[model samples]
Target: MSDQSRLGLINENPIQNGLDAFRALFTSICTSRNLPSTIDTLRQLGVEDLRNLALTLFTSLRNLPVSGSLHSTSGSATLRSVLLRLITAVASDSFDFDRIKPLLEIAISENTQDAQIWDFVSTAAAESTPPPRSIASSLQQTPCSQNTSSFVNSSEYRQNVDPVLKLELEHLYVGLPNFHKSFFGDIPELDMVSEAVFRKCTEGDSPLFKEGWSGWPAGAKESDVLTWIGGLISQLEAFADNRIPTSAARRKLLAQPKTPLEGSTGKRSMDIGFVDSDIIYKPDTTDSRYRWAHILVVGELKSNPKADIASAAWIDLARYAREVLAAQDTRRFVLGFTLCGSLMRVWEFDRLGGIASEQFDINKEEGGLQFVATILGFLRMNEEMLGFDPTIVTTSGQKYIKIERNGQTECLIIDEVIKRAPCIAGRATTCWKAHRNDDPHNPLVIKDSWQYVDRDEEGELLQEATEKGVTNVARYYHHETVRIRTDDDVRNNVRKGLDVTKATNFQPKRTLPSNVGGTVSRISRQGRSSSSGVKRPSSETDAALPPSKRSYSASPTKPNLDVLSNRIHRRVVLRDYGEAIYKASSRAALLDALEGCI
Candidate 1:
């Protein structure tokens, strides 16, 4: 049709004309090679006109005959592409973000069930290819960085908005069960610490149990959680003393060796420890026979569900393990647990063996009470049975500190032990994403190409990561600190010197899978066993595990970039760490300072 004829169709019966003429007019627009002029024309149209155009395209798509001629179907597909391009041009116009924001939302809200539209919109929004400098660039300039509020409110908001949109749109397309799976997800259950162990989810603030209770509580503060855990530990101690129950088993418990559990209150730094654990079981320093007096059990408590556990919990746990591994007098394993309300993760760190028995939530073991009791029992058992030789202390130990932007704290540990230990040694600098299709049942795909990035201690990128088929540079940002450790750390811990008997005695009765948590309907006592009955990570598990598993094969087929951008991949980004390193010093001053030092 002529340009005049198309204009007449719209002017005559705007709604009907739009629906009928959409395919023909859109095809013309796509072939015209005049997006610049079309964008100008779209900019001049009022909101109603834009809405009519979007509605017409959507209706045309929905009403298209399924068994139409191939030529007609191909034409419809081409028209759909043009409509997508047109919508994108309008949404990302070099005007104000607020100007077209409503129109975009209306289009999305009206067609929530339209898969093709969602796919198109999401891909357009998450386009990793940086667009020409628009409002985002101006707001992201160096000057805005000085003002956190201004930068976050403007630049960060716009860039971050698209990712959220992509997620919501995708969620609209999945089944309810899959949606729930995606929502709750799975967390590893550690032997000593797990969400399954803590019972009494509702009751709170009772005496002795004072302000005491169990299970994950909503709106509970950090201090409140500490109080509940303290009470729980005291009750456990009393129970082992035959104080809580009057059954025959109570006396049997009293006959077992007793290990005191202590929380941080007014203990000295030298006596209490190096790391600030919420609760610790200090070695029986009063007794001279034990030889080593390092902190035996270190537990750090956190309440913020939104905080980055990979960094805060994982890093601090590794730091504590490192300290124990390097202690001048101790070569035995130090137990570490991070408790976030009902969520619990556990690790065992030793000088020779390294760190092992990593578990996420053991809340199923009698609500974690049994897990704690087992841990205490292991500590009470004979050290020789547990494979501990107190005489084998490392004489030449070195000291290192967890370098924080705030400051630093000294950690005394065995230098050689760290070289061989599977301990978390450093932070991640650069990152990459890859697909793992080894498991036909649960194939892992490259969801998001964007990576959380930061500079290492030596100012090097942590990730040299790339995704399949993405020729453009992936989006990268720095954020929360995640300590880097691997399955080798587990192997290292086991090899150095693990007490097979003791590890078995301390293992929880029931071990939960690594990726699930909630009310425990039934407990399965099918404990995993090694030759020693001690729980050790399998080589097969390491080989299949995504975090530690690396593939060096040639890159596979590239995915549809737009579709790939909308895949479910969650990442935590923190403030840039290198900002300070490069801030005050310039090239000239640094050269002179280095020259003077040399």
Candidate 2:
């Protein structure tokens, strides 16, 4: 009898009592923040424990043909339960053994080490296969040999072979930044293992196994891997020929508690304590070449409900990469954040991070990628709103992407007017790289500055806007309604106005010609404090944009009254302190001259 049958489970009957029993224990342990006690196994006793439980189900040594993956046994009936649990677990924040180090390492090590008889493919090849080229010549010609670790400790090499999996879990074979470089040498990559598995099959000692692309971590070093794969073509050819037909009798397994589209009832709110400073990735790493992952967080409606590996790692990995980047960029300090609601919010100021460190704190430390995320989020909304209708920006809080059965599009509900905009958007490349023309909802999403092309006719639109009704100054400025105006005009307005004022006052006794290029000198002298976040204007700064980038307006135009108003505003701010200094200096000079005459 099957395990489910022996345990009194039947199809089409309620799975509630069994799954509920699982959930109660899982929640208790998680609430207690219990680390697995012995580290031998993450207990597989809960509904949410199904993630770790799935590992047990697939890789189990016993019941090979009955309770296994096609590569293993036959009667694994719990695939449906595990799938629902994985989807819900990933969507929420509760801990899963699969994501932890001890368990993950063990699982990876098993597939590579193959200690269990069921997993043991004939190692006639890996143990004895000759190197494709002469060993000496290959070692000599290889450029990487110089840096190769030469202290071949047999204990360390033998340590690579686990009873089932090595402690390093075969992943740090590539290297973990926290660990030394020669950690486990290298994990057998998927292609290398697949080739070895298939090659052994033709030698009569191999068992029949179903074949397909094992999910490869789509990461760095793919090209060189393909070259190594080329040497194993015969194994590929054989596996292609001997693969078993997928069973037609295999029936669809229903996800036990969920409807076809939704997730589980255990999609509960989780609490992750703030325990450590978040680290940033910087250029200071002893090993500058490190591989990290990035993830994009989508909203509830758009959140993926799949158990596939890549999808599962997306958002968390992106967050990991963001933290690493911030750590490296900031130096010494590690910043942490909370994955809060629809909005990306910072948790750095929480009681723990606020009081816990000596490096920096509430008064000294910097708010991190969480701050960056909030800034980018606002910037993303403005990119669309500014492009759709510059005037729409003042009301951008209402602009959002809407997905319908027909197509995806952005919707802006202004007052009662609903404006529909194209859902397709572009990604920000480096400030030096051209922006990418791609769909925003690319199953994989990344965060960077975003860009869009706005209609130049926006100024005319603004004029028409004001002509229709004259009191919307905030909307007009917010939208850059006169965005058609070139930066040259703004530059000239500032340089001819406040910049000129500051320079003239600084050299009170010396007369500098206004016609000369003192504009650059004047800009540099004011040296605005960093609080004004714009980069300081340089001497070589070009206020004149190319003709294509320069915007101009014609036809029934409103006077450049707003443009003039902004120029006046700049003059007012620039003049405030400069005027005060000039007045004080003039008073002091008069007093000094009167005293000299007496």
Candidate 3:
């Protein structure tokens, strides 16, 4: 049993897989893990067709990995930003400008304090300065700004790969350098926006939108999405109102009123206008609505109870709603949840009581209408709660966009409504995941020492997760194990595991003498000193050294650094709102300018 013998065992054992299999396994694993995936060489380039040939590569796995582990508090948001940027850039189908570059710059920045990105960007700018000879003078017209008014303009948001941005990010980890490459794993459905609504395994009938929705060529998909987005914006504006509107005058009494006026339904609508005051006033101006709506939508999505939902699939739900609302109507809406076929709703905020309703299936009065479009893609409120009457269910009725939630639920809805519903004032200070477990046949596993984290607008913890040790909110990622070694039993088990994996000399490499007579220095290859032919220090002398200088402590009883850091957690990273803000407002002279403003 010697170091040489251990090496011999390592060399003797045959690897199960060949080089090709190994490469495939490595690539696939690396991508899913968001590890450092590498490319061997650069290959091709076209004007705007950017296919990163050798940029990053992953090997295809023979079969799906049943489970994956997440890096503790590597800070997913930091990486998510990069992946989103890549998604935006690729979908934009153009790269002549800095469409994704500046956004990328904002993500990985250490702090607003010292923007090292600016230095690299400046350098890239100098390097990529296009000559006037072949450059279109159009490039110099409107400079990029943080404002949507400026950034979304075809002229301003152009993806012309300003050489400066390319060079700036070349050396940058680019927020989540490997996130886009893998980290979250495969989502092939996102290849197209329509796929967000359609079930991948089961291709159903044509879209059931009203008659007018028919003639739109596939290209009009863009228009449809836009209409959905508009409605969400309207819903959000209504939610932002300092005060919410009252209930619909408890309309139950009036519904059965014996004395009725001529053309009552129409007047009832007018009654809703004149007398009834229950409504979140939808904003008259455009920007106010979507702004508030954006906040709410993001908050809810972050509040989801499952990790699978957090993947890019969730974005599809929001995006699809936006696209449909943009093309169809700019009003309140309801969508179908993917799971359990339930109805979901968003009430648009107007000066009047904002309108909202849950979607129902084909027939009136059917108990299980199955209005939910898809499951696992969205959260669904039971049909009984929404009270959407079919008598008034028209494509033109109050701007309801329908859509399928990202596999959680199904149904179409206006994009803006989805966006706005996120902000609508509701009972948010509740544990959604906990409530689900109370239902019959709940299967969500409860873990010990686990807790939920709900951050308020001011970045305060509003609520904690269930006491049984399960994460109800998806946002509370396994931010490092609170303790790698928990109880005494766990500590003992880990010690055993370590002993099994110890780099002991009993399993040595290369043929060595069966005897133990070898250099003491070689036995402790990594320790002590480099002074050749010098006697090693005694245990007493080693003990005299400071704690930091010692190679190993006398015992393995020390606490784990990761566990300690989690127990005494530090660092507060904000969400993407800053991105919207920085892009919209005038560039701050310093990052500190944002402090105390909210």
Q: Of the candidates shown, which would achieve the greatest lDDT relative to the real structure?
A: 1
Model 2 agreement with the true structure over 1-598: per-residue lDDT tens digits: 4444533322333222322222333344454565553223344334334343332332232212221221212223232322222222322224333343332233333232323322221111122212222234323321110000111111211111111111101111111121111111122232343344444433453322223112211331223323322333333433433331232111111111111111111111111111111222244654421221111111111111231111222222222222222222111111222222111222111000110111111111132211222222221222111112131234344422121212443332222211111011111111111111243221211111112122133334444566576442212211221221332112231121222112211223332111111010001111111112122111111111001111122112321111111211100000001122335467778676456446
lDDT of each candidate versus the true structure? 0.29, 0.22, 0.21
Off by over 4 Å in 3: 1-43, 49-126, 129-308, 330-598
Predictions: Cα RMSD each? 21.8, 33.3, 26.6
Task: Pick out the ten consecutive residues of candidate 3 with the lowest summed lDDT.
Answer: 540-549
Candidate 1 ranges beyond 4 A from true positions: 1-103, 107-116, 119-228, 235-369, 374-598
Could you say which candidate leads in TM-score? 1
Give the better candidate number (1 or 2) by lDDT.
Answer: 1
Tens-digit lDDT track for model 3 on 304-390? 123113122122233222222222212222231211111222222111111122222311222121111211111122221122212
Superposition TM-score, candidate 3 onto the true structure: 0.19
RMSD of 1: 21.8
lDDT of 1 at 526: 12
lDDT over C-alpha atoms for residue 478 of model 2 = 13
Q: Candidate 2: TM-score?
A: 0.16
Clashes of each: 37, 23, 108
Measured with C-alpha atoms, the lDDT of residue 348 in candidate 3 is 23
